[model samples]
Target: VNLRSFEQAQLVGSPFIATNEKNMGGLPDRTDDPTEEIIDDLVSGRLPGVLILDPIKAGVVAAETAIKVHPIRKGKSGVPDEQGCIDMAYNCNGCGNCQRNCPNDLDLVEGVRLAKEGDFSVLSDLFDYCLGCARCEVDCMKEVSPLTLLMHAGRERIRNETFNVRVGRGPIQDTEIRNVGAPIVLGEIPGIVAIIGCASYGKEIQELYKMAEEFLIRNYIVVVSGCAAMDIGLVKDDEGKTLYDRYPGDFDRGGLVNVGSCVANPHITGAACKVANIFARRPLRGNFEEIADYILNRVGAVGVAWGAMSQKAASIAAGANGLGIPAVVGPHAAEYRRMFIGRSDDDDTWKVFNARDGTPDQLVGPAPEHLLTTAESIEQAICLVAKLAIRPADNSKGRMIKLSHWIDLERKYKGIDLPNDLEKYIRVEADIPINMKEEVHEYLKQKNWQPRDIVDPTLLKRLCRT
Candidate 1:
């Protein structure tokens, strides 16, 4: 079921139901005594095994009844806890910092502020303009981490607003899976690499597209999903081709596929499965299962997911890993660290994970050392993953490429240049000139100290004694 439909079912006082088998019935009417009828049917052995309902509605009712039953004591005020107030304050302050530092001038501050004030009318509006580049957090010294906060808050708002909403049924679109060109088929092309994640207040996911472009130049298929896809305008390619184009490269300069929204991450997994299937059928000495096992155990056909806060990415990684595919998450390390050690004001710890064995192998460090914004680290990790994908004994097989060479190539090919609009955001710090020699000489003179037949030309020149 889609999110909208699930939410609507909750709002209309209807019990949200899930069943293993179909053909129960359509939605129940509002006037019908659903609870009584459901109970009667259950008692008579006519109902199914399980039934579910929206817990939020029950909680709301319970809270309301409790408030009505127990009035606030004499001097006590009726309000949420101190932690809730702190969270509200933190969100407001962090969002304010994000807006101030945002290069694109997004109203993140206003959106979060509204959320704090229990106003969500503009929540979706705020999300629509977020580039998800994560630059806002990058520039903030307050350690705001607006991206995750926004996603959580947005999801909550969506839950509240869309509850009891209904979605009309529609036929599922049949999507085709095809290689871009003869190069892809002739073993001349590198396999696809899809970078999938969410776009919150930060723009960190934008780096995925940059990485994709680099991978594309090396003849690798590149796919992006979720809010990350939206940032780069992946919903539609430059040539107006559907996301599932026969030739992704031809449709969009080269090799960029936006699978869909967050839930559509299964598309990436399916694509990888298709590639594995094709590889398995090519009389390559191994079947699909064997190849999958090999890739899972030996070759690193790994999925790298950035921004781990979203359950969607975690779910996708689990599915892929279950299929014997290696997977890595960029943000889980920080989460683990935060879970273990409390957060510090100046700390910027980011984490990365390897979920190949269903056990997380985490890499945690300062953000500058581990996270995005530092291209060198990301490049190295990608190179390492690629190197792991190659079979050691196969001399004829092409080896995985190194990230250093890729980085060198990128540096050589694309010179340092900023976008025109971003020029205003650049600030040049002033340098103070200091004459060390003159200062030293002045100090020496003041102390009535003189060198014994020794003179420094630089010092003498600075002291006007040359």
Candidate 2:
């Protein structure tokens, strides 16, 4: 199959659907011809992506698909990847296209070779950001579906191995946020730190851990998912303690929340949606654009995907953008083939329309200039994360929190001087801290930054019917 053409066809709003099969006793048994089942599903246009839920059946699928399988070995008595699973990779021609196409540059050929020899440990770590987007499958010269390999590998490693795997912790619901009252007065919250995305971090992993710790200490609510969550748990501070071990795992302020695997990522965006509908009392049922506009103008949330790769990562970033939440990607994101950077100074670009009404009055100034951006380094990513979290509705304390980190990160990485036009977000002198008051005031004056009051600070307050 020409997967790119197939994806393009699907991209043009093709009505492809996903379906999970029901097996006997709630566990799918190994079928004799798993590839035939997969092909049948594909031809039926009901399987956009295949999710391997059964470990035993995963091997059957892996063998037919000719991909590496690493099902999580279950309990202490669980057996390793079966010998039949190893024999599946005998047809691989040692091509490196799959690895290059992978977001993390994981060598699937070697991984499969290792899996065939019963040593699944070598490629077990590659599952962190296995988006299952099927790009690797299309890249295979041998026409093997690589994601099925990932699922097979994951299933084997998770079900058969005796390693310490981070168990999936379902989605974060809106009621949970309401119970903690974080969404009630979101403006008072400094920022919502969404530490999400792929696990392709370099030295940035250490910096990401410190950044999360800093935000937590500064009273920002931190949320995580996918391999990013796993990476955060794996890091240790100078004192040799992981943030996951030290911090309270709550959804409240200053709490670090890991909302499970990639599929559960909607919970992060769902929390933002609830802020507009539940706390702010805006419409939500069929008003996705308006709710997203409210989030852009009012909610102080930013997504940081330091190691983003895969088409699924792109879609996640795009989804966040559509919801008015901006996402910052790491250096490796450049390999994702595109980045969306908005220019703040451009008046034409800094505008949003109220989808409810086609009137000019309901049009609002864009709260944020960019929806998705890429950082060159870890320090830059931290700075961008702090900057992206700043919204038009931020309170004085919230502005102070965001600016402090912004300036500190700028000084640490770029220079002591703040980036040009940062004063646009500084609503008042009171937003500056007492310690940096002198320096910031001097810089603002030098840049001829005028004191401008933001009247009608609500970006999407005006509502009109079409």
lDDT over C-alpha atoms for residue 176 of model 2: 67
If candidate 2 were superposed on the true structure by all CA atoms, what would the RMSD be? 10.0
- Per-residue error for 74 in candidate 2, Å, reads 9.6
Over the stretch 166-233, how does candidate 1's per-residue lDDT look in tens digits? 11112112223343322232223434465666534334544454455556666555666665555444
Provide the TM-score for each candidate, comma-separated. Answer: 0.40, 0.65
What digit string (tens of lDDT, one per residue) describes model 2 on residues 1-466? 2325334434332222212354122322224445567645534445443545555665555454432211212122212235545655555677877777775566777787776576655555666556555567666776554555565567854555332224545655667666644432434566788887766443455667877887888677888888778877767667867787677767777878888887788988888888777776777789986788678877878888766555676678878988989988767667667667876666565544433453333222334557888878777777777777777656677667777877777787778577676666766787786668987888888878665443333334355344
Identify the candidate with maximal TM-score.
Answer: 2
Candidate 1 lDDT score relative to the true structure: 0.40
lDDT of 2 at 237: 63
Error of 1 at 428 (Å): 50
By summed lDDT, which 10 consecutive residues of candidate 2 come out lowest? 69-78
